[model samples]
Every structure is written in C-alpha cells, then in structure tokens.
Target: MSGFDPRPLLGKALDQMGELITTTDDSQRDLPTPCADYTVSQLIDHIQAVVRRIGAVLSGQPFWSVPQSIESTDWPADWAEGRAATDAVLADDAILTREVQVPWGQSDGAAAAASYIGELAVHAWDLAAATGRSERLDPELAAAALPAYRAKVPAEPRGGDIPFGPVVEIGDDAGPYEKVVAWTGRDPQFAA
Candidate 1:
C-alpha cells in the first residue's frame, strides 16, 4: 500500500457500505446475515463502529475505546456522523504519512485504511444478501479489496480469533466480489 493513496478507494467503499446501512429498514433488523454471528442490525452496527474506530485511529485515539456494537434505528444519521469523522481527519494527505499504532500493530495510516477496505467490501455484500438487495452491490469495490484480503488472511487455519470459516468453494462463474468474501471464510451462496 506504500505510495498508494487509499483515501479515494476507501471513501468509495465506505459510501457503498453506508448506502447498505441506510437502506436497511428496522423490519429487517432481526434477519440473519451471511455472518452467522450477527443479525442484520448487528452487522450494521459493526460497520458504523468500524468507521468510527478508523477515525479514532486516524486522530491518535485508542481505537479500542470505541464500542464494538450499537443498536440504532436511525442508521443514516449515525452513518453520517461516522463518515464525517473519517472525512474530516483524512482530508489532509499528511495524516497518511503518520506512524499510527493500531490494535493490529504499528503501521502508517495508509496501510490501516487499505486493510479495512476489504472488510467493508465483504460486509457490504452481507448487508445486501441479508436485505434482499444483492443487485445493488458494487463488484468493483470487492475486486479492489481482494488483493488485500489475500495478503492478510490465509486460506486455512480458521477459527476462534481468526473470524473466518474455511473458504467455501465457488464455481468458475462466481464474480470477483464473491471470491473476496469467500476468501474471508464466507460462503458465496449464503442463504440467510
């Protein structure tokens, strides 16, 4: 991720995830998602939390101080605030050069931003699949995030803190987006 400005792509990924959050109605909150551990509401909350968490990291705050989940009915508004946090902090390119210590270990800001792009991309599909809005998914974001996912998460030894299941095999017809989630231990054919 060196020399690459992740702000633009990260912004796009966030916007894509935010739209999924905004469109998720309360009625669907109880529905299960591809992430077996999280309901639709839980997943949305995680998404918002991660955005805020990123902001905390960018501003040199303890990212773990941010809660891992929230229960919200007004996600669009919450999403705006979370987005604004990152927007304000990341506006200056200088922040990207800073050596920030994140929970995953110390690295420059760009690596941190690049790391979450793949995560958000997978969750975007999770939201879509859970909400019956898979049609709206942006495949390009998943495609962009694939290399990052591959570089970090391995294809085996999943469980516990790994947060991924064994990769579910996809057919040759599966698109780039499906492959991205699959690499993170997701089943491309997740039915819930």
Candidate 2:
C-alpha cells in the first residue's frame, strides 16, 4: 500500500489519544517515558505543537515563521485542543492533498498526512507508557506508519551519532501495539 492515504490513520491516531487523555487520571501526570528526556507533560506538549503545525499547514496558513518554545502547562488539555484542531485540518479538503511547504521540506497533502499520522502514533505510545495506560495503535495504522517513519530517518549506516539502532526487529507473533511501540523507539515493555 505504497500509495496509501494517511488521513484515516491520522484520524485513528487522534481518536486513540483523545480517548486516553480524556480518561487518564490527573495524578498520573508525572510518569517517565522511553522518549529519553521527556516527562509525561513535555511529551503531551510536543504532540500538541506538532499537531498544531499540521493543522496550520492543512488550512493553508503559515507554519512556524516564528517558532517559539512553549512552556509545559495544561498539557493534557493542550493535547485535546490540538487534536481537535488537527481533526479539523484533516477534514478540510483544501489542505489534504494540496501542495504545501512543510517545515521539513516541500510535500504534497498525502506526504504531510502520512508524516503527521506516523508522528502521532509514535507519541501516543510515549503518552500511554508515561500514563500507565493500555492504549495501543491499531495494527493497520502501525503498519501504515512504518514506512513513513523509516523515510524520515537518514540512511546513514547504523552506529552513527543517531542513536536509533536499527529497524526494530519485531516478531511475526508480536501484537500490533508492541510492534508500533518498538518501531517508534519506545521499549514496549516499559513500566511507569
């Protein structure tokens, strides 16, 4: 499915996170994650920033002409609001396949959608782990995300300054959730 459109996956990722964030207890906000330096709050904020940018691009607005760092505040709520914004963008026909310049480079609607979906799935696992939640990416969503993630990584041979070891080797018997987490650089077995 090289020609796969990423909108459905993007929607699914948003739905998954929206459900979890709504239900997560406020007390679990301080847990750690496999995303190295990020705490639960920071991860949530990062997801929000990325989603917001995607929404802007999809709406034919400028993306980050003046990118400012955000302080971590009201993160869970930020995620919910950002998810709504991203959902709005995905539903907007004007931006989805329209040629737009992204922060990384120039891309069409399909590439942008795929990148956004793949990013959301990765961070959802980060949030799930930090919150001690059982949420997982849909199998089809995870499968759709792999190629996009791989494309984002540089092709330099392993053991460079990039810490990513390899294309995570997951078993055929592995569940979809595990595969997704592992592929995204999260240790599937991490516990808060």
On lDDT, the leading prediction is: 1
Q: Which stretches of candidate 1 lie above 4 Å from their native place?
A: none
Candidate 2, backbone clash total: 0
lDDT of 1 by residue, 1-192 (tens): 668889888888898888888878899999999999899989988888888888878777776878887566689998998899889988978768787767667878888877778878898999898888888988888988998778777787899766789988888888987899888887888776
Model 2 sits at a Cα RMSD from the real structure of 3.2
| Candidate 2 overall lDDT versus native | 0.68
Model 2 C-alpha lDDT per residue in residues 80-191, reported as the tens digit of each score: 7777777777876656568777767777777777777766777777777777765554567667777766666654554455555454666888776677667655677888
Per-candidate clashes, comma-separated: 0, 0
Instruction: List lDDT for all candidates, in order.
Output: 0.84, 0.68
Candidate 2 clash pair list: none
TM-score of each: 0.94, 0.79
lDDT of 1 at 189: 80
Flag regions of model 2 displaced more than 4 Å.
Answer: 1-5, 61-69, 154-169
